[model samples]
Target: MALIEIERVCRLFEDPKRGKPVIALDNVNVRVERNEFLCLLGPSGCGKSTLLNMIAGFDHPSSGTVKVGGHVVSEPGADRGVVFQQANLMPWLPVWENVAFHLKMTGAPKAERRERAQKFIDMVGLRGFENHYPSELSGGMNQRVGIARALLMNPEVILMDEPFGALDEQTKMDMHAELVRIWRESQSTIVFVTHSIEEALALGTHVAVMSARPGRIRELLPIDLDRPRDTTSAQFNDYKRHILHLLRPESEHRLEQAA
Candidate 1:
C-alpha cells in the first residue's frame, strides 16, 4: 500500500490586484510507497515546491487531500520533517543544539537531546564540529546539520526541497552519496524535489515528472538502477535520456492533451 497519497489535489493563489487567481497545481495525484525515495522533477515554476509544502502540512490545498500512513495531514507535526532549500539553522545555536531543537521544544532533557543529536551529527560526518555555530560551518556542512536536525525527529516521512541546490557540483555529488547512505541507514520514506534530472535519477527509486504551469504529473517512472549509481555508465545515460524526453515541453503537452 502507498505510504502517502495525494488525490485530486489543487492549489490556487489569488491575485487580488489583477482580480484573478493563479493556478499552481491542477488535479495532482500521486502515491509514495514505504521507504521509497521519490523525486518530484519539473521545470521552474511548475509547483513542485508548492506541492511539497502541502504534503509537509506547511500549506493547504484548495481541493483534495494529502494522507500520510493512512492519516490525513492537517497540520505540521513531528512525524514529518522538512529540510528546505536553505539550511535554515538558527544562528544563535550550535550544531548539536540545532539538531536537537525539536526535541528541546518537546521538553527532552539537555543531556538526552545532546546524546541523540550527536549520533546523527556523527552520522552526517560532522563528528568534531558539534559545538560550531551555523555561521562557522561551510554550506555543505550546514546542510548536513539540517539533515541531521530532521533525522533527530525520527520522522516517518522526510521532505526535502532541493536541499543541495545551492551547493557546487562537487559538493552536490558528495551530498548525494551521503544522502543515499543516510537513507539506507534510516529507512525513511523521502520525498525530494529537484530540477536536475541527474539528481533525481541518482537519489530516487521513483521519479515523478511534473508539467509546466498548473502542474500535473506527466509521468511516474520507476528507476531500477543499482545503489551508488554510476552516472558515466551506459545504462545510466539510457535512463537519463528517457527521463529527459519526458520532461520536454512538447512531450508534456502531448500527454496532457491525451489525458
Candidate 2:
C-alpha cells in the first residue's frame, strides 16, 4: 500500500462573511510513497497548506479520506512530525530544550533527549548552538532548530508548510542543500508545501501541482535529475517550463471548469 494515501478528499469551511461554505479542496487524490520527497506546489490560495494539514492530521476532510501508514488520520499523532513556516520556538527555552520538547512532554529522561537532540542538531548543521535561545539565533538558524525538533521525533512522515519561504534566496539555497542531505541521511518521507516552483524543482523527487482555490491535483511529474540538480540544464529548464505551463491562469481556469 502507498505510505500516505489521500482519496477524493474535500474540505469545506463556513465562510462567515459570505454566509456560505467555501470549498478548499475538491475531490483530491494523491498517494505518497515511502521516503520520497514529494513537493506540493501551486499558486497561493490553492489549499496547499490545507491539503498538507489533512496529511498531518491537523484538520479533517469534509468528505472522503486521508490515510498515513495505512491508518486513517483522525487527529494529530506523534507518527507525523511537522515543521511550520515559522520556527514556532519558545523564546525562553534554549535551542536544545526546544528541539527535545516532544521528549520532555512524553516524560523521557533528560539525558536521552539531549543525546537524540544533539544527533539531529548536527544533522541540520546546528551543532554549536544547542544552549542558545531562539532569540539569539538568526531566522535561518531558528528554522534549523525547528527541523531538528521534527527529526528527533523519527516519525514515519514529515509535513512542512513552506518552511523556507521567508528566508533570503542564498539562505534558502543553503537550507535546500541541508534539507536534501538530512533527508538522504535519515531516509524520511516528506510532503513539503511550497509556492516556489524553483524550490520544488530543487528539492523534490516528485512535484505535484495543484489548481487554484478549491484545489485539485493537476499533475504529478517525477524528477529524475541527478543530485545537486543544475538549474541551468536544458532538461531542468524543460521541466520548469512544463510546470509553468501547468500553473498558468488559462490552464487553472480550464481546470475549474472541468471540475
Candidate 3:
C-alpha cells in the first residue's frame, strides 16, 4: 500500500462577505509511496498548504479521506511530524532541549531525552550548536533544529510547509543538500509545499503541479534528474518550462487560443 493516500478530497470554507461557500480544494487525489520526497508546487493561493495540513491532521477534508499507513487521519499523531515555515522554537530553551521538547512533555528522563535527541541533532548537522539558544542561531540553523525535532520523533512521515522560504539563497541551497542527506539517512516520507519551481526541482523526487484555487493536481511529474541536480541543464529547464506551462492561467491560454 502507498504510505500516504489522499483520495478525492475536497475542502470548502464559508465566505460570509461573498454570501457563499468558497471551494479551496476540489476532488484532489494523490498517493505517496514510502521514502518519496514529494513537492506540492503551485502559484499563490493554490491550497498546497491546505493539503499539507490535511496530511498532518491539523485539518480535515470536507469530503473523502486522507490515510497514512492504511489508517484514516483524524488528529495529530506521533506517526507524522510537521515542520512549519518558521522554526517556532522557544527562545529560552537551548537547541537540545527544544529538539527534545516532545520527549520532555511525555515525562521522559532528561538523560534519555538528551541521548535520543543527539542522534537527530547530529543527523541535521547541529551537533556543535546543541547548547545554543534559538536567539543565538541563524534562520537556517533554527530551521535545522526544527527538522531535528521532527526527526527525533522517528515518525514515518514528515510534512513541511515552505520551511526554507525565509532563508537566504545560499543558506537555502545548503539546507536543501542537508535535507536530502537527512531524508536519505532517515528513510522518511516527506510532503513539502512550495511555490518556487526551482526549489521543487532542486528537492523533490516527484513534483505535484497544482492549479490555482480551487486547487487540483494538474500533473504529478516524476523528477528523474540525478542528485545534486543541475538547475541549468537542458533537462531541468525542460521540466521547469513544462511546470510553468501547467501553471499558466486559463485566461491566458484562452487569449493565446484567440490569437
Candidate 4:
C-alpha cells in the first residue's frame, strides 16, 4: 500500500466578484511509496503548494481526499511535519528550544526536549549553535534549524514547501545533499515543492510535474539515476529535457484540451 495517497483531489477558491469558483487543482492523483522522496515541480502560482498544504492538513481540498498511513487526514497532526518557504522560527528562543518547540507544546521536560533537539540539530549540521537565537544565524543556517525542528517531530512524512528557495545556489546545493543524507538516515517519506527543475531532479526519486493555474498534475516521472547523482550526466540531461517538455506551454495546452 502507498504511504501517502492523493486521490482526485481538487481545491477551489470562491471569488464573489468573479461569480465563480477558481479551481486550484483539477482531479490530481498521486501515490507515494514509503521512504520515497517525491518532488512537486511547476511554475509559480501553480497548485503545487496548495497540494502540499492539503497533504500537510494545513488546508483541505474542495473535492476528494488525502490519506496517509491508511487514515484520512482531517487536521494538522504530528504524523505530518511541514517546512515552509521561510524558516518560521521563534526569535526569542534558542536553537535547541526552537527545534523542540513541538515537544515543549506537549509539556515535555526541559532536559528531554534539549536532548531530543540535539540529535536532529546535529543531523542538520547545527551542533554548536544550539544556544544561539534565530537572529544570530544565516539564511542557510536558519533553514537547517527549520529542518532539525521538523526532524525532531519524527513524523511519518515531511512536507517541504520551497524550504531552500531563499538560499544561495551554492548553499541550496549543499542543503540538498544534507537533506538526502538526512532522508536516508531517518527513513522518512518526503514531499517537496519547488520551481527549480534541477533541484527536483537532484533530490527526487520521483518527480511530479504540475500545471499552471487551475493546476493539475501533468506527469509523474521516476528518476532512476544513481545516488550522489551526477547533475552533468547525459542521463540527467535527458530526464531534464523530458521534464522541460512536460512543463512547456504546448504540452499543457494539449493536456487541457484532452481533459
Per-residue lDDT for 1-259 in model 1, tens only?
6999999999999999989999999999999998999999999999999999988998999999999989888999888999999999999999999999998999999999999999999999999999999999999999999999999899999999999999999999999999999998999999999999999989999999998888999899899899889999898999889878777787666788899
Q: Which regions of candidate 1 deviate over 4 angstroms?
A: 251-259
Give the winner by TM-score.
Answer: 3
Give per-residue lDDT, candidate 3, residue 161: 98
Encode model 2's per-residue lDDT on 1-259: one tens digit a residue. 9999999999999999999999999999999999999999999999999999999888999999999989999999888999999999999999999999999999999999899899988999987889999888999999999999998989989999999989999999999999999899999999999999899999999999998888999999999999899999998999999999889876666788899
Question: RMSD, model 3, all Cα superposed?
Answer: 1.1
Provide the lowest-lDDT 10-residue window in model 3.
Answer: 248-257
The TM-score between candidate 3 and the true structure equals 0.98
Error of 4 at 26 (Å): 0.3
For model 3, the superposed segments whose C-alpha errors exceed 4 Å read 254-259
The deviation in Å at residue 88 for candidate 4 is: 0.5
CA error at residue 177 for candidate 3, angstroms: 0.4
Model 1 lowest lDDT segment of ten: 245-254
**Top lDDT: which candidate number?**
3
lDDT of 2: 0.93
**Residues 1-259, candidate 3, lDDT per residue (tens digit)?**
9999999999999999999999999999999999999999999898999999999999999999999999999999999999999999999999999999999999999999999999989999987999999999999999999999999999999999999999999999999999999999999999999999999999999999999999999999999999999999999999999999999997888899999
Residue-level error in angstroms, candidate 2, position 222:
0.6
Error of 3 at 203 (Å): 0.4
Superposed Cα deviation of residue 126, candidate 2 (Å): 1.1
- The lDDT for every candidate, in the order shown, is 0.94, 0.93, 0.96, 0.93
